[model samples]
Target chain A: MKSIITEPMIPKPFRIHRKLKETHDTYTIELESTNGADGFPFSAGQFNMLYIFGVGEVPISISSDPSMPKMLKHTARSVGTVTKALLNLRRGDILGVRGPFGSHWPVEEAVGNDVVIVAGGIGLAPMRPVLYSFISHRDKYGKIILLYGARTPEDLLYKKELELWRGRFDLEVKVIVDSASGNWRGNVGVVTTLIPRIQFDPLHTVAMICGPEVMMRYTLKELQNCGIKNENIFVSMERNMKCGICLCGHCQFGPKFVCKDGPVFCYDHIKELFGKREI
Target chain B: MNIAILECDHLQILLDVLRKRGYQVIGPTLGEGAIVYSDLNSTANLPIGWTDEQDGGTYRLKKRNDKALFGYTVGPHSWKKYLLPSELRLWKIKRNGVSFQIVTENEATRKFAFVGVRSCDIHAISVQDKVFMNGQYIDQHYTSQRKDTFIVAVNCGKAGGTCFCVSMNTGPKATFGFDLAMTEIIEGKNHYFLVETGTELGAEIFREIPHKQANEKEKCAADDILRKTAEQMGRSMDTSNIKDLFYRNHEHPRWNNVAERCLTCANCTMVCPTCFCTTVEDVTDLMSEHAERWRKLDSCFTMDFSYIHGGSVRASTKSRYRHWITHKLATWIDQFGTSGCVGCGRCITWCPVAIDITEEVHAIRESETVIGKQKTIVKEDIHANTGTLSGRTSFFKRP
Candidate 1:
């Protein structure tokens, strides 16, 4: 029998170490454990429930590298009440940290295969961990490619990191925008439009995706058209979650609870209900 | 285990014994024009000589010809109101400037002895066990309250107007999960209770009460009441292939029909004995000095239940109804390895619009041929709308 913690609902206090403005509305906040606990070890595509005191909690994906778990981090857009509260946090401001919950991307499983990571808008936050995992274990895979897109040139996240990865000779990083206003001399369209330009052995490739449901749906079709098997593709999902431990039932996606069974799932398993209305 | 027959007048002795054992006895009582479950300090508190008349969107308490303490069926209040609690203080926080320490709640101490629990409700408790107690992440309050709690199960002597435990194969007879199972038999001039001990604790408690060794005739009489209750079931459900039926008929037009009538008031979920969905609330003073987090009962029928940054996923009434019933009967099995419903029929009796779930499922099953034709049309429409990938935003439109 699995022995549960006496109080799973109670969160350990974590103080904000640093905050970075990623976009016009999004911010990434780094945190430190208040009690000097060990590093909060976690994998790619997992999310944490960040509780803003006196307000509420929201589930944000871990954006920092898994290799640097001590510098815990989460990226969120100021969309709702709790997220807006999250954006208002400054250095040393304390908040509650519940998890590093849900299933993670299969980086270990994709060690021998070519890796293709696709992200859109704020969705890049969740995929950043996967890219870091790939870089840390570069010799394990054949080829690594990153295809990221956003609403506009200004909406792209992790601008400095993208440029640094672009300079690397071993990795290929391609960025896109739906509509450009500045002197942008790059591919411009939806993220799926960039998928056709990349080259990887579909028979031995694993495509990882993290984005809004609509973007992921179109991307799935484009990746499948490139001969990538449904089983080889993975996607991260989001829903209204209250208890990140799967008790709240708000994050149910079809037969599975997105909080527990996934925030990351194999495309083949959820293909039937992925794009179905209101599911 | 032991079986005994106690006279009706001596029923007070059972309550007295349980109270002395440090249990807060809770049972059915007449309140708000219905037989509601509440704290029972004495035998007079039980709704004796009272039987409830239940049907779709209706419930009325009527006088019974015989004085049977456990005559009424389940009411709006379920055992969940005590076990899971409508509102629970999960934890409290004391803010000191920019940083604070986590403070856990006091340990739970009150032990409860639930009396007059029906057979179907006994099954409901076991169903919730999978969600709260027997899972990887256990609810702390649930584990504490349920640890040493006692259950007194009563076999139904007659069926309610909306009861269908026989259809779900849950009850009419309390076969297990009870400390004591009793069948109230009111023969001519002889009103006694044939009680059987189900556990060591039950046998110990049974020894403290006034009783006589029940003969074979008395045991057979108890079985006869359960048999009669089973035959008088007011409703029935087809359980075979239920999960597949729901998945195949997700887009069935019957959902729209039910939506037009469903108020989305969440009455069905509130009355359901096994619906365990919840949402949390954070409260604090104006100074933000002290903060508290409370877990409140939530339902899938509400528009806010599925809210995200953009909006509620299941925005339409039809989709909300589809999510609820389908989750209760189909996906819940896939999730928890068993159906969420125990066929208690409280949901049917409490709905304001009288939307019958069994009727809706029957409607879908009666017209399963519509599945192929409807699915094909929707698939064709999606294909036509988006001739190519990335041409359309969403292939699946709002229902």
Candidate 2:
């Protein structure tokens, strides 16, 4: 029983310090470990298995800057039962948190190279940390570009942050929506359509993409068409995950366990399995 | 390092030795309509004189002229039933006033001494060891059960209609992954079991049983039994570069042909020893004060196995069938460093429609269309030619 007590599946209690409504269906919650322990430092693109007391658990990416490990944050959509419960959580509410699991974006590897971050819908949440890391050390990388897309204007996450990032002269930000509504006056097309607007040195560019599988495929094709080698591209994948530590077999995508082997993978490593319709 | 011959009737002594040591002996028993693995208190429970005739989608127990203690190759149920149990309680959550408290399930306590494990099944257990123990996160429940298990492997004296361990290079003789290995030999009116110890635990138990040193003649009989079993294999698969075969043939039309026959019943996955996919089920009491999470066996053939946020990645029967066979034969090596299938042929026998994996792989291997398609795949992999594919890449300005 003592061995079971210390099992990896047993999540530690965390208090929701603050909860910000990101959109109609999504919320960004800041968490502080209840035990006051030195929290595990996580890298950009890693995820946490957030558990609602009596509901269920789901893998949500750490949307906050990785450098500030003490202030843990996650952005989740109210799509499933567990996530809906998470979105309803009030400040000081106790919840279970496990992980900071899976592979992270190669921010260190792209230090001297031009970094292109592409995301779609809520997919931008996982890419938020990468943008933070790049901007924090803006002098280390070359051209820093972010191309984001969503279904509509209302569906966009971190709208204020996008405006703040757009104000920065050092960063190149392009935002697009599939079906624009109201008095929206911006790029009204897929994210790939904005790729040509940003100038990057193809041979020295490192592209990191996270989105729907179809969007990821098109982004990879666009990146490769710009003379970006497959080895220089990375994509984050998603599957139904139970144990974030790779014990449960639900998150397998071919040979890779999305929870462990990647939420982030080099394009060449998974290119064969990528765009595979039946896989 | 001792070989001994125990008389047929003295098989009870072997069970008695294990029972005295507080090990609940589990072995094959004739149950309902077929031979299944279950607990055995005495030799009476053993499938004595009962030899199973097995084929794709067929199984029958027939009484043999000689009363052989271990004549069957393997039953539908495997040693995985004890190690990787179908239903396992992960944890229980109790309402602690306003907050919830988690209650972890205790580790397995029963010590198991498996009586009639086969070579292929032993390999299957080892394969699962790689999954449950060797992984980054250890399954404490599985480790506890596996650590307490004492294996008594039985060398196959005959092969079933679907048996293909010889092709997989796994069986017919119990070579490894066993505490004790035995070969049952019955000649004329005399019958005895030649036993050999594989571990110190097996040697300790063998010393307590009534047995004598086996001579050269008796050793020859044991070797002859295994030799005949190997030669009489019912099926053979060419495993040369099998990983590449499935990797290249994912789009082969043979999958569609097999999908027409596959019922998607998941019977094959349920019986397969190495298929370790599982899903978590959460249950709550009516009062909602107590809730528990149970891990249950899940099959790749299920419609929701590969489900994400939207829907299942593998929705069609063709994709499901291809995923199962290809994962077992190809991608498994990349994941676990070995083939997932031990070639027990249980999947072939237990399948309702008798869709043989060997036959499916053969059709893919023999397809002329796949050979032609491979050339196109090679060409498509060249980045320059596929630059304009789908017209989406053209949006990126060439620099």
Candidate 3:
């Protein structure tokens, strides 16, 4: 077998600079450019095919905002074979990155409109870039609200960032836990409960929601009940994507390829597909 | 295109002419209890006076009353078994310290000429071309093998028990995408083959064969034979608004009923001529310096086919089967601009449960009508504006 010398479409063997724990089961790793190569170019919601030498490859969304240059960050949970190997990586280990594949959150379209960010568990990783865009250009939007939920208080991610956003006068941050213990004092319900407590013009709001399939379905239904248009709602879909390109045919939902046509699609565009249990 | 006649006595001369052209001729031969596609050097190697009876996961060989070389409808083997292949080497990887380099190889270069190809198999090859060669990311191996191949298509003289190509608008008669097409007709004490050239290369071959031009009676006989084959089809799928019918019946109970019997054995996809899903596996040698990457055929019916971060998204057999059938019949048109199935009947003939797609679609249509009638009777009492508010509110409000 001969290696065809084509131009590299993705980054290879990027060195990890630091690893930080977001939760007991989750960790965020920061990667630096190897061989003095430029950092991978990617949109916020797009993901990378991270490969370990002997293990395998898995798709992980970029957690760090795109505004940060020369470094890439990914928040991963210890899930399968490839991911378990990724979690064992140290500060100076290397891994392969083959994307920034899939459609990104439409930050430019949400410009000048009230932005509602809803996330559950590790789903917040994909929304991190859009959140940074909002925080950096806070004057360009109307009102900004963030509603996030996790299994427990200790399971919450981005603890420092949540505290910083809570102290800001221009932003609203609401955190929820599915079940609570004695030490917790914040709201103890699902993230959808906080949507009704906040006040915003449904006509002027553009929502970016990422979560489990069941949670996103229920939240979209709740948003429609609040008079939000389907076009104004965006959701991220997770599937078994083998080839980040569209050749493998694993991640097809009806006519669209989740890896190519979307990972982020407007509710109006995919309503019929989402109606069924699986397509 | 020119039509020429090849008398039954001159069949051996035509095979010798093809053999002298430096092309490996492959056709139907007796192998493993049934007729299979294999290399042939002479006319004697062909399955003369032999035919096959095919059903779901069952095939049997029977002797015909007359010595006709091209009388069968189809067999378990299609052209894809040779062209696309079951397994292929994708690339080789070598690790140097912390970095890895991938090497892709070119393995196929031989020229082949396939004889006695059925019309449905030709359609299946055309459908695969849209996927492997016509797309943006071209599969180099498939392109290399298919580029220099010669196809001699044959019109079907009989229909199998599982044949349904007429309903899918694929075939019963060979129309195009072949270098040469022929229809064999046998009468009392006389046999002649009606041949037509589709390309310049086919014309060259026709000139080499000693034959007379086809008359009007021979053309009429060929058409009549094709019409009879179409009429004798064992099954038919309604193509009118089929995509919309499947879309509306996604939640119908018929899917649940079918899932109970589906074993998900994946034989249908394995035998299908156009199913092109593949999975990659990397193996490293004991030295750890050399690694080989292999691409193997994969199917949607497998549990790991839809494996995600947490688990399989399609955990139930019903959802997996629905995904395969709906994608093949409906959504594939939107994806690749053609239906995934060419109506080769391989799926029906190879499935362990004998799950006929035409039967499944009819069941869904009937169940949908029943469900529609039941819903209409309940519509008067149902509140359209503000019904189920409490249930919805409670489900969303739960912690």
Candidate 4:
């Protein structure tokens, strides 16, 4: 119950509204501001610096709808130290938040063309807001295709939402698992295998991909093979980020600060560095 | 806007005037056998008649035959230790029952009067200004310290062995960004400082100290000193096509060559005036009631600089060196619209194994085994022996 400070580095506290178990390793938590503030307004691909009370901070993308700003939802797998500490939090726990930072998904660029979204593993979380935007403005685009892949069936995030997206008539969702068992009745191949099955205008397609750097690297070739120009391909890149601004110098991928110049960059802009080893 | 000559006899009046104006006077003084920037309430604290010899992996202090206050090139420290600071407590977290409140550091600040800032370091400060002040988000701490600082920039009378300010187009002469720019002239019988006022406050302070209007003789003496310093440059690099040279040659053999000698000790970043990367440390009390967010200066050479879930992206020394050099020389232009290096040569002189950036660039430029252009990389001395682009305007100005 104190006056809020507006220094960019400081974090604003958000109370945990709810937490849902997405998978054995991944969980999606909903947060609401405890400090009598309005909704968090941010673009689809923007991320936030979530701070635990005594632990460190982690950069997680907002996975909820931009329209629903009061409730901020983040889907995270317990991968590192900060994420591991975040997974143990319960309801009513206060979390420090900064941003909705970085560049958003190129939803505007994809309008009036066929939109293809490719996600690998937990990469789908960053693109969830893009999906919300696309579904609302579904009439503005031609074909909408979502191609997602994971380690196995159990590792897939947002299974219920994936099913809902698949049931929509205007949208086409295709998922592939590297390998699966126990009545897993779906395609068992890499996500690139699904690129040939979808039907979209190659010249007019605007593809947005998010995933592991290796997966996105391979997807770039697959998309290019399908006659998608490098200019029309947009990929969300992930690097270790701190400060959520350009100051930390941690998230630099070549000339671009992944936190500032982009978390999302057009393929033409970063094509030179995309496949370069150890870059 | 007026220039004056302060006789060496009345130099203490300048420090006294600054102290009376409620400004902490920080200038070079002999500390641990090296000229260090520290508090000076009296003129006796100044490093009089002292000069330093610096080269790759070596430094030593020597005494000058004549008396001159600003006789040395830059040392291992910069004003950044005061501006952004080495360790800064950003905010304090206090746990109060179920709810805790955050308290940001908002204390009142005292003004600073930096007495002996060099031209290359002046450019270093300005480069940092572009990164911290002119960016999308302004750093409040850096801005607060920088805005009120009274800079007394000095034109270097001589160049260090590793100095390349002339090649970087940053110095030999202080161009802009200081409140006052001075030059030392230790002629046979007369020892005086030719000081030029660069701002209103600088003129006012110069007026308080005892000085006479600088005539053409004093002006020529100052200019001639800077002219000789420019000619005596120990190193130069071809910055004409530096961006392309670094951006295109990521896999150059010179990087692997430098990695073999580099210890990854991070001495270069520690001494670099323009390196502003920072990391935060969270310390909590035993009872877990109080936590403080402390930000410390970090270097790209550290293994944790690129740490992610599994490991670091730049795990090897080769990649870290590649990131440091490329970011400073090339990528900084893309991110900040300007190059990050000031050519002060701290990275060269402080490097334990003496890995020189100018030499590395020269080596990479010497053997043109570049990416993409798998076309023959003709080895040419195109950029060799160059800094001869005289009579041209300075390419790197303080943004």
lDDT of each residue in B222-325, candidate 4, tens digit only = 98999999998888988988898888788866677778888999999989988889988888889989888999999999998888876889999999999999
Question: Model 3: which docking level applies?
Answer: acceptable
True contacts kept of each: 0.78, 0.52, 0.45, 0.52
Which predicted model would earn the best TM-score?
A: 1
- Candidate 3: where are CA atoms >4 Å away? A1-11, B7-24, B134-136, B204-211, B368-399
- Give residue B379's error in model 2 in angstroms: 21
Per-model lDDT: 0.89, 0.87, 0.82, 0.87
DockQ of each: 0.60, 0.35, 0.29, 0.46
- Which candidate wins on lDDT? 1
Candidate 2 retains true contacts at a fraction of: 0.52
Chain A TM per prediction: 0.97, 0.96, 0.95, 0.96
List model 4 lDDT by residue over A1-279, tens digit each.
Answer: 222224878888888889999889899999999965689999999999998877879999999999889999999999887888899989988889999888888888888999999999999998899999999998999999999999999999999999999999999999999999969999898999899899999999999999988899899999999999999999898788779877878898998889987899999999888878767
RMSD of each: 6.1, 7.1, 6.6, 6.1
lDDT of 1 by residue, A1-279 (tens): 475766668788898999999889989999999877679999988988899998998889999999998999898899988999889989999888888888999999999999999998999999999899899889999899999999998899999999999999999999999999769988898999888888999999999998889999999999999999999999999889999887888999999999988999999999878999988
Please give the lDDT score at residue A90 for candidate 4.
90
Which stretch of 10 consecutive residues in model 1 chain B shows the poorest summed lDDT? B390-399
Instruction: After the best TM-score superposition of candidate 2, give how far the Cα of residue B275 lies from its true spot, in angstroms.
Output: 0.7
Winner by TM-score between candidate 4 and candidate 3: 4
Tell how far residue A76 is off in model 2, in angstroms: 1.4
Query: What are the clashing pairs of model 2?
Result: none
Cα lDDT tens digits, model 3, B1-399, are 688888877877766777788778888888888778999888898889998787755677899999999877677678888777777766676777766676667564777889998888888888888876765456667778898788888888998878889998888888999998988898877788889889998889778888998899888988898899999887788777878888877886767777888999988888788888877666778887777756678899999988887688788999888988888888888888888877778788778778888778777765566556546645743745333323222211111
Ranking by lDDT: 1, 4, 2, 3
